[model samples]
Target: MSRPAGTKDVDYAQSMAILRTRFEWVMLIAFLIFLAVVPRIFSPETVDIINVMAIWVVGAHGLNLLTGYAGQISIGHAAFIGVGAYSTAVLILQLGLNHWWALLLAPIMTGLVGMVFGLPSLRLKGFYLAMATLAAQFILTTAFLFAMPGIVGGISGLTVPFPEIGGMSFRVPENLYYLLMPTAVLMTFFAKNIARSRLGRAFVAVRDNDLAAEIMGISLFGYKLRAFFVGCLFAGVAGWMRVCYDGCVRPDIYPLMDSIWYLGVIIIGGMGSTMGAIFGAIFVRLLHEMVLVASPALGSFFPPEIAGQLGSGLGLVVFGVVVALFLIFEPRGITHTWEILKGRIRHWPFVFAPG
Candidate 1:
């Protein structure tokens, strides 16, 4: 039987939706396959870089969820990561807990701590909220240092235990890479799904206009707190992975500067995007490492001490300038560019889809 025009339109829409969903899944599967086979193709040094990129991807995803999708700026995200790292370290060292169990609990503990700090967000906005989060960084770091010198070892850092899986230790970077990669991929998937859900819409609505969102029956207080909790959960996972990779957890490891670096990753990568988090991490980490590698070559012309200082300082300056340029010119980020390319490929032989 011939369908009516309206019914045909609905069928077309549903068919397109299915096609888009399948395409997304196919892309994701292909990416995972590539990652799984990467160790076979790359040198160990390159694989180490890939592992670091994976860790940063997790941290960037956490920051993006809070500041990008939810419009909640956090200058002290690394503090929450520290909380997770220390919690895992303490559990393994002091309590003699299994590494796997400690890793599982780390994020939950960090999320609770994040919720406590996030309470201030109910009353604060913009700069004030950012300042409040920054305060969390100082207070937590100082507390870990002077307040409990015996426990956290003051200036000296606490050693982290090697992770064990199936009675085998993961001491090598390659082994740790395999351990971290799955968690990173799962977290990225989770973030993407959440961003496509109703909760994501609520976040954007509140971000655009809190008053209007509240008027529309969204609970501003509830959603904001949930966002903080979820965001910190990702941070905790990242921290747990960091401890596994480095085999140590120090209070100084998560400094104020580290927090600033994370924020920079999200801005340069693209806010409110899962792909942005991954792209930002890879771009920033690779750029930093490239500078370090080129430092000696650039240093030959200058005195040793001066070269060292200039190389480090110039690298940071260049990083800042790149971020500034991206913010001003490509605020939507590399993800936006990727999207345009994808759209063009998908609609070949057609000018463009009507808005």
Candidate 2:
């Protein structure tokens, strides 16, 4: 039977969409498989780097959800993660809760806190909102520092129990890798789905034009809160995973600079793209490690004291330069560059000709 012209066009479009999606999934799966096998082929040190990269990826995805998709600027994201980490620590130390349950509930509690912070967004926008979030970072940090020996242990920090599954405690890097790898994969998957859903669309709409979104019957307040909750939930999960990875939690671990770095990750990663989150996290984290590794080599050219100082300062300078370069040259991020490359490849036979 011959289909009508409109029906045929719709079918063709749907088929192309499905093909594109399948291709993306295939590429992602292949990359993940390569990552999964890296430890087997490389040294333990390399595996450890991969593990750290995975954790950053998880945190970046959460930040991406807010700053990228939802169009919310958050400078205090590390505070949210700190909230989750400290919450988990308190639960285990003071409440005598199981580590597993603490991990599960930490994100939920953090999400609630995020919603409270997001409430300011309904009345504020742009720099004001950014300032509010900055305040959250400072206020939360101070609270953690001054909450006494009973709350967050003040300057001392809290010890995190090793993650246990049934009878197994993940003490080694390899064991922790197994636990972290799955969570990272699942978090990435969830982020991708959320970005493709009605909620994601609503977030983009709010970001693009909150007034128009409101005119279209979308509740600006509701969706903004939802974005905050979702983003903070990811932060909370990342925090829980970090505690498991580090075996302890400290207020010093999450500082104002760390929150700024999270924002930089989303910006350099391409904001709304899941692939962007992965790319940004890997690039930033690796660049950080590279600076540390190269510090000694750089130090050999200078006096030992000078070299040590240069090494300490170079990391921040390099990070700042990278962020500035991306902002000036590739504002859409590395993901957009990948898209352009793929598009050119897909249309290689149909290169445009000067008319």
Candidate 3:
């Protein structure tokens, strides 16, 4: 934590403060103000996109914690999310719980489910662990699709009405944006704190080397399961937001592709940092949105039959190429790139100076 000239910490509190400088505080306040007015300034469609981005940010944070910090890879995160969404629906519809209560309980239930799936980490890891989770993906999907059609809604899925208070309906994007954004921000704050805590340090230690961590008295099984529980917990929050956004829950909504994209989000945003999750979500979501917008215009240049096919697959092609390039050129992700640029700016003429 380098400080500007004439800035010196005189107390422990000031030294440990997150917003150590006045400039940082100013920027934080400005960013919050910008978020506050987004829905009022943007169109409904754009607001809807931002809402999805917020939800993805929450989910990506979870994946980052598991894969990035804990070194536990999961390609089945979307299934965990499905577990959360279905849990929420059951709590609300079958048990007669309030929507808000369902929202809280669903993620806890999902966390427990994640821990059960994570038991294999006791004996397996790396590629084998991924395969285990991949199996989890398929098994959960099957359960969602066919285990109990009457309860889970089968292919038809479950419907949830908009939450209401004081006669205000959250069915519209504009109204829902308020609910989603604050939750995103709060979750982000919570994640940032977690990353700075003892638990986060243990995760980092386990990630760096499990043998070394265990040598230092850190319990591998305890931390690994905790990582899975915490990671999937965030996925559940994202699932709850998804239900609010779409007013329904279906097996199709939580697909294998989404779980894959969540990994890409953390990879591109830079893996070990909290902000990487936010940056990655914004980048990937906006990229997909761009593909959606350009597909029709691109289709006009080709024959009708091929045009439809090209448009349908263009996003995947572009996304794959971009991720490949990022992996090759900047494997640490956008966060590292930003750090380098900031380092140069902080040193001015001595651009190569170390911070």
Question: What's the TM-score of every candidate structure?
Answer: 0.91, 0.91, 0.97
Q: Rank the candidates by TM-score, best first.
A: 3, 1, 2
Q: Which lDDT tens digits does candidate 3 get at residues 113-167?
A: 9999999987888999999999889999889999889888898889977777688
Residue 187, candidate 3: alpha-carbon lDDT = 90
Best by TM-score: 3
Alpha carbon lDDT at 248, candidate 2: 88
lDDT by residue for model 1 (1-355), tens:
1222223324655544423355567986897899898878888888888888888899999889888988888998888898888888888888888778886898888888888888998899899999999999998887767766666667786887788878778887677778889889989988887887888888888778999999999999998888888889899999898899889877788899889989989888899988899999998998889888888788998999899897878778878898999989999887888777766665554546423
Better of 1 and 3 by TM-score: 3
Off by over 4 Å in 2: 1-26, 349-355
Candidate 2 residue lDDT tens string, 131-232: 999999998888888877676888878886797888888877777788888889889989988997788899999999999999999899899999999999
Q: Given candidate 3, what's the lDDT at residue 67?
A: 92
Record all residue pairs in model 2 with backbone atoms less than 3 Å apart, i.e. clashing: none
Per-candidate Cα lDDT values, in order, are 0.84, 0.85, 0.89
